[model samples]
Target: MAEENRYTFTVRQATEADWPGVIDALTSAFEHDPVMNNVMGGDGKSQKVRDLFGFQIRHTYGPKGTIDVAVTEEGKILGAALWISPEGQKGGLIDEIRALPEYAKVLGAGLLRAAIVDLKLLAARPKFPHWLLYTIGVHEDARGHSIGSHLLDFRRFQLGELPAYLEASTYRSAKLYAQHGFVELFRFKSGKPVLGMLHPAPVTQVSKNNPAGR
Candidate 1:
C-alpha cells in the first residue's frame, strides 16, 4: 500500500529515454479505462495499445507538445501526462491517415478502421487555441498518492492564463476534471458518453487580482 504522505516524487519534463517507462506506466494505469480500451480496441496492455501510444508520444513530444512524468527520488517513473500546445492542434484527417500504417500493423485493418472513425468523430468538435490535456495516467500502486492531481496542478500553474481542454470518457473522469476547474462544454454519445470540457483561461482571475490590467 502506497501512502501519500510516505511517498514523494518529482514531476518533470520527460526525455526520449523515458519513453519506455512512460509507456509502461500509462499502459498499466489505463488498462481498464473505458475510453482507452475503446480507442485501442483491446485490453489496454496489448501491443496495439502500446503501439498507438508510442505513435502519439512520438508526434506529441517536440516543440509543439510535451510528456511530463512523475518519478520517485530514485528515478522510478510513477505517472505521466501528455499535453499539446495550441500550435500542435494540427490533427486533421491527414494526420490520421499518416498514422494508419502503424495502427493497421498493430491493430489489424478492422480495428484500425473503427479506431480511425472514432478518432474522426472526436476530432469533429470545434477547437480553440488552448492547451490540450491529451492523457494522464498514474501507476496503479501509486493511485492514492495524488500523482494525477499534482501533474494537473503543475500544468495549470505553468499555463497560467491559457485555457486547457480535454474529453472525459467516463463520468468519473468528468468529475475529476470538474474538481480541477474544468467545465463541461458538451457530450458526445458513441457507445458511451464522452464529455468535452474546457478549463477557461485564468485571465479573469488575473484581472481580479491586478485590477489595473497589469
Candidate 2:
C-alpha cells in the first residue's frame, strides 16, 4: 500500500463482487478516450457506452486473465487494469463476440462494424507470446494522484520474466507506458493514433547485461 495525502492506495485482484465499481471506474476514466469515442459514436456518456464497457469487463474476467483494481483504504475503487496471459489470448475474440450479443442488440450494426475495425487493427500488429495489458483506466477524479502508475507497477512486478504488451489509445497514455519501459512497436492511423508497445522481460535485460548467462 502507498499513500498520497488522505488516500491510502492498494492494489488487489478484483473479484466478481467488484464488477460494478470496476465498470463505473473504467467508464469514467475512458469517457474522453478518442478511440472509445469513435467506436461508441456520441458524447461518450450514453447507455450504449456504459453497456459496451460493462459487457467487456464481464467477458474479460476469468481464470486465464485477471482484472486488478486500485482502491482506497476506504474501499473506493480508483482504477483498474486488465491483463490477459498468452493462453488467454487464444480464444479472446470468440469470447468477446459471445459476450456482445446483448450489447449488439442495443448498439446494432454499428457495434458489429466497430468490432471488426478493432479486430482488423489488432490483427495488423505483430503476433508473439506476451502478456496483454488489455486496459488500464483511472477514474477522472483520481487522475493526478499516480494511481495509474501504481497499477502499472503492480503488473510489472507480477510479470517478472514475461514480456507485456498493450495498445495505447492516447499519446499521453503511450508516454506513460514508455516511462514504464515499454517501447513503441507501431502506431495505427485510426480515429486516434493507437500506439502498440512491448515491455520486454526484466530477465531479458539482465541476460543481455551478462553475456555468460545467455
lDDT of each: 0.75, 0.80
lDDT for 14 (candidate 2): 88
lDDT of 2 at 24: 82
Residue-by-residue lDDT tens digits, candidate 1, 45-135: 4566667677777755544588889988877889999998877777645775776676576667556545765565556555557888878
RMSD of each: 3.3, 2.4
Clashes within 3 Å, all models in order: 0, 0
Pairs that collide, model 1:
none
Model 1 residue 119 CA deviation (Å) reads 3.7
Any idea what lDDT model 2 has?
A: 0.80
What is the Å distance of residue 87 in model 2 from its true position? 1.0
